[model samples]
Target: MSTGLAELHEKARAALDPVHYDYYAGGVGDEVVLAENEAAFRRLALLPRVLRGTPTRDLAVDLPGGRLDLPVLIAPTAFHRLAHPEGEVATARAAAAARTVLVSGMASTVAIADVVTAARSVDRDASVWFQLYLQPDEDVTACLVERAERAGCTALVVTADSPVFGRHRRDAEHGFHDLPSGLAAENMRDLPGGPPGGVRDIVMSPSVSWEHLDRLREATALPLWLKGVLHPRDAELAVGHGVAGIVVSNHGG
Candidate 1:
């Protein structure tokens, strides 16, 4: 029997071209961490409990200042148009229907405001978080945080991974650095004169640093979180920097 996740994977594979799928699924270096990410989950085997006297089970979880009917949260992905024409809007609607939070990717094709609107269309009180990619320019990064707050995003997720672009040999083999013109990086384009250089320079944000985290916190009132942290010391440092949360990720590793 196919699980819901398996069905979605099949659908995604069928709907997306090989290049797009590889771009979304591929990871940096040897992809050891990427494989470990799935392997780690499988390591834990759930031990089912015996039947108990219960009429119903409540799945609702109270988070920060909001309540989630489900424990699931949507992970951010770039160029969602590669998966479906509706892009992040479609995923946002699905997340809202499930009463789960949706994290909007910094490289999303749909504008942040539009994604928030899509969530509101499904659930008036949808919980939405905006993922941030630290840009080379401090001003640009600050502006993005401001825009996300204005869009009513509940939190700011600073993706600390991919300071530089990862080398995905699969994408390189197929000359897949380019995305379709209409599906450009919306959030990143909010930069003053737009991103520097040509298409290959997509992930070339060189000026991001720990100090910028302090600047980011000062720039917005939204709770800040550091994603892509793998080391315990990094997690402690994030806590020291006044970060509300830390996402332990290895960038598809």
Candidate 2:
């Protein structure tokens, strides 16, 4: 890790509860992918143009969803309240201030509308995309898409990597299975097959396929982005399915 990031990680470790820290830091299985991700990033070299001194440089970009003042974006991460009290709300605010996209997680501790409101409080034109995993129950999946639409998300980020939960050895060792008291995934409340005020658990299934993506595309007018596609064939398939974009990711691997 870079010196700055290492310092930040150390601070987070020092401040957060052990279980929560492990939940945030640990990846699936023995975390070989995690090590490799860092290794891969280190090997990359950005060759800057030399001898053409400009007064200022612009890093802005325009995507189908919205214009970004910087090329950087804040990708989705789940259950942020465990890390800080303000959680996704604070994250939204920061992203707004930076004039970049904040792909709010489906498993956010705060509700989607509240997160969007928080971002708008900083910049009215701020773009906040919703990140979701397709549920086995189509009704539940549709409900999530509706929620995102109602909350004013500019685009939908469908995470296609996690067909099933990966085995995080650290989490298993630390016995970190559930959120602490009073902190639930707020977006899951009042879902199908639950009490009026109950929250349903998010489900993952290997049965999810391109047909499901097709249905989702038909359901929402918002730009749809497919996340966690690493295979070239899968990328081609995504294009065939008419996704607005493909986020090349390995689900943090």
Candidate 3:
């Protein structure tokens, strides 16, 4: 019998085309960092102690704004359509059923509003976080934050690991520059004027800075979080910026 995660992985592998699978699954250069990420988790040994009249296990965790029934949260990843036809909607439903959190990525094919609807369908009070790509324009970033707020997102996750796109040999080999025609980056589409180039070009917002954090705070009342922070100093800086939380990640390096 296969486990739920195993079944999900197999289904995703089968549903997505080979090139798309590699693009979503592959990493930069030699992929040593990717290997290390999984290896590091496996190296840690879980030390479970004998129960001392503990009736049940409690997985709940209290976050800055609310309580999470399960400490586990779905990390943001681009282009959920590659995983299943329902895209982020399906993932959000599953997360809600598990009584966990879902962090929707900026590159998600499903609109933020749709994801929010799905989450609400499962649990009216479900926790959903929106992850931003920091579009090439400051105004675009601001608009995304506002839209997420309208969608009832509880947190804002700014992914700052990618200053410039990394060299992904798999994507380069397959010429995978943009999301497939039917799919789109909804956050980018919500901006006032269209991005500098047509949708295919990866827009890099050169304006990302500490000052941008202030702009983000001004944009919405939702708690802010900075993902992709690996350094202790950067984590400190995020706190100084009045962010509520920090995710210690390197973006699979």
Candidate 4:
């Protein structure tokens, strides 16, 4: 059996298809950020004190929507079906069993309703947040948000910085764009009052600004959390919009 994440990653690389494996394993150009992520862990100095506490401890933490089983949360990543056959549905079920929150990606392979149903099948208190990708059309964005609400999502996580997708050399080399059959982004495939052919062609508004946040705030009652913030100035802007929280990141910058 795999003893740690490193071992698990190796096993997954051997088990998963090359297209999916590359997508998950590869980072942006030069992968400096990935290197830094590992270096940051190495830089941490653990200071264990004598008689501080017992081995057992409470891991729960209160989030905006509710209490999380642990302080950790699963980041929103696309195409869960690439990793498992059940896709985001299986992820939702696992999150329910763990009593933690799972932020379902907007580009999830499973439908939002199906993910919610899977989580509900295990526990009523399952906390699922929606990672929303705002489109150029307010109507389209609102429709997505409304569907999340109907599907019992507790919060809305807007990926504020990924207005444009980054170029990944690994993905290009592996020809991931060709896409295998049955791997479409199901959440984008269906939206309330949305047009046909899904949103694969939709470009995120490069003009997205604070005013857009105001419009998005009006669109949903769920607590809004902005992800992909890089600078303190941007964090201030998010706070000005009255966002519930800000996830500070440059998205592999």
lDDT of each: 0.81, 0.93, 0.82, 0.82
Better of 3 and 4 by TM-score: 4
TM-scores, each model vs. reference: 0.89, 0.96, 0.90, 0.91
lDDT of candidate 4 at residue 57, scale 0 to 100? 72
Q: Where does candidate 3 stray beyond 4 Å?
A: 4-11, 195-202
Candidate RMSDs in Å, in order, are 2.8, 1.7, 2.5, 2.2
Deviation from native of the Cα of residue 190 in model 3, angstroms:
3.8
Candidate 1 local lDDT, 1-253, one digit each (tens): 6677669878878877988888887776677877888788768776866787788888899765256897768877888888889999999999899998999988888889999999999999998899988777666777788889899899988899777777887788779877777667777664665545322224556577889899888877888888899888898899999998888887667
For candidate 2, write residues 132-168 as lDDT tens digits: 9999899999998999999999999999999999999
Candidate 4 per-residue C-alpha lDDT over 54-141 given as tens digits, one digit per residue, 9 for 90 to 100: 8877879988765788887887888888889899999999988888889998888888889989998999888899998778777778
Measured with C-alpha atoms, the lDDT of residue 39 in candidate 1 is 85
Superposed model 1: Cα runs more than 4 Å off: 1-4, 47-54, 195-207
lDDT of 3 by residue, 34-151 (tens): 8898788668776787966888988799786456898778999888886678989999999888888899988888889899899889998888999987766666677777888899
**Residue 34 CA error for candidate 1 (Å)?**
2.1
Clashes of each: 3, 0, 1, 0
Determine which window of 10 residues in candidate 2 has minimal summed lDDT.
Answer: 1-10
